[model samples]
Target: MPGRMERMRAERRASGEASFFYREVAFNADAVKVMPGEYFVHSEDLVITTTLGSCIAACLWDRQAAVGGINHFMLPGDGASDDGGRYGSCAMELLINALIKRGATRRTLEAKVFGGAALIAGNGALNVGQRNTSFVLDYLRTEEIPLVSQDVLGPYPRKVCFFPKTGRAMVRRLPPAQREAAIALDQDARRRASASAAGSIDLF
Candidate 1:
């Protein structure tokens, strides 16, 4: 059965449907690496991936519309400026609006959230992770979106891969070394959250 599916997928790929999910080779499939304050949306099976430590990533799917999107935000709320995806509010709005424009209905949206880790404890720094987790949960609740799944508020970082069309996700806790790198990236993203560099909008 697996071999037969592989042959079918190969034929699909050969015919130029480049984004179908193939489990065995999925790690090497064409992918979009979403940065902090970035998002990706698709009505197909393209992979959207991100790494997070203290930030949050939200994956939203409209079951009826069969479309989904994922966003990564550096901060919990708007920070003096509304120009970037770094704020969860802005990031969430962007993804929701995009999905709606693409024929998804807000009434059918469901959500899965990830990330928000306390990497550096007791540093007098803002507990950004907890804040991010709280903010997103509240936002979704207020918007009436059902929270179906989540893995948040841990001591480790995570790498998330989301399949938009199927609304399936895989999350792996990073190893210690890569966890440290994710912490570094999270700190950098927070520091530069107010900057004007455009965050990405990827289809795959």
Candidate 2:
């Protein structure tokens, strides 16, 4: 028989959530994996995790309300299309809106950004990592959200884990052996973005 955690995760999956929920044995707590083009918000003791190469993951928290969320985006902006959380513009809006819906206030929101590495060398035009980092910083500035911390703009991929309710985050720089997989994933996402014509994103 499935255990309590397994059953709960199964239910979440049935509801069409973008990410999969599970238990992180290291933290001994419930966790969710936020993949590229996805975001998750919660007010419970849940850890949200994601791996990135040239992509970015922004963790937003409203300490006053004890609510927070995180998003993983592959590109800087949609330019005019709404590719869900695949673009930074839509990802930021979605994460903020979701947090507000969970009782968080914009005025008290704080941000911690991660990822955005120049994993692909010798390709200035394809260096989406720098662009993504710039976009997220500008977006936060324009929205007046305080940026508490950030780990970005390097040559290494990262694995990030964020605790929503407590607003805690951890980032690990992956070794060269893992960089190939991360780079491949980001490249594929970029290709899909280029091929797809999405809609415009709505702001909250």
Candidate 3:
């Protein structure tokens, strides 16, 4: 059998082919850590993808304007914690704000939610995927954002591809071993959170 690294490389190659070719943009802590209070915009044909275990992506589109955008986040921030921009609160906020800035109103906006996969082996309470999924749904409901569609919450990891220009999003479920890797990525995120609390440095 192929080793872990070999498998990862294969997946990367496959993902490259699966994804739409376009201008890429990446965000992180030092790069202003896309918080709930902030927003951004891009005019190019954009593709945003994030692997999921407990995280969720909110894709917002202004169909009449022919513009769209997506945000990826890990939790549903309820103003209870610092959130560190990992929660759905931050993600949803950024996405909505970005759309509003792009001239999209609540009534004119359409949404597609993705991720929140329980790809890890676990029970209900411990299932971060389920929690994240619930968080996003509640947020959208309270915010009154018309949810056009969704593909979320299952035992399989997913790779998402979103085209902002056309408001088209595709999700591909990863195999079991790939799902395990996605869970590992989630664990790594948690570890980084702990390290951050201790004033330690970590990077992706």
Candidate 4:
């Protein structure tokens, strides 16, 4: 028998299937990993997913243009990898660039950011959630992209759905334990990326 929290999480995951625009965007690891330094874009529709631990996602919308995009990244990429700038710097740029491509600019854009949850129970040394949140806020400030809303930094994982057409972002909090598991998965991904990079450098 599952506990109350477990049952609740199961319920939420099940409910997600009922959404009309529930598109499963894959990340890293397995066939479903959104790497630490990547971005994805889509038009005005509900983009929904679950996240835990230290990973963070940002959602951008342009009201006048009825266009928007979302990005899920781990660390703030330093522009060294093939990803160009997949982390926060790249993530922000990707979303903005997509919007610009669609006729939206910083002067006309509205943004809403989510995730960056600290789901673990212990005083973990890897507070990627906090770091991610800080990086995003700083980036937005530096770029002058005007953030209209945000839901970040908590003890719970989150389910975020953003409607680009309407510029509305919906967020639901996940249980604490569930968030911890998500964090564990995130750490494992970092380990894998590190090992892969080490192997590549040796080959060079």
Models 1 onward score TM values of: 0.81, 0.88, 0.70, 0.70
What lDDT score goes with residue 6 in model 2?
73
Best by lDDT: 2
From the highest lDDT down, the ranking of the candidates is: 2, 1, 3, 4
How does residue 203 of candidate 4 score in lDDT?
10
Candidate 2 backbone overlaps, count:
1
Candidate 3 per-residue C-alpha lDDT over 1-204 given as tens digits, one digit per residue, 9 for 90 to 100: 975334433553211012222233442201111211222333345455555666677778887776776666654554335543455676566566666777777777788888777665546576667777888888888878788899998777777666667788777888876766787777676554444345322222
Q: What shift in Å separates residue 194 of candidate 3 from its native position after superposition?
A: 6.2
Best by TM-score: 2
For 55-113, candidate 4 gives per-residue lDDT tens digits of 67787777788887666766644434544433567667766886788878788777788
Please report, as a residue range, the 10-residue window in candidate 2 with the lowest summed lDDT.
195-204
Better candidate number, 2 or 3, judged by lDDT = 2
Model 2, range 1-204, lDDT digits (tens) per residue?
A: 986557656664311134587779888988888888888888887788988888899999999999988888888876445467777898888888888888999999999999889987766755788889999999999999999999999899999999898999999999999988888888887766544653322111
Q: lDDT scores for all predictions? A: 0.78, 0.83, 0.60, 0.60
Error of 2 at 87 (Å): 0.9
lDDT of 4: 0.60
Model 2, CA-based lDDT: 0.83
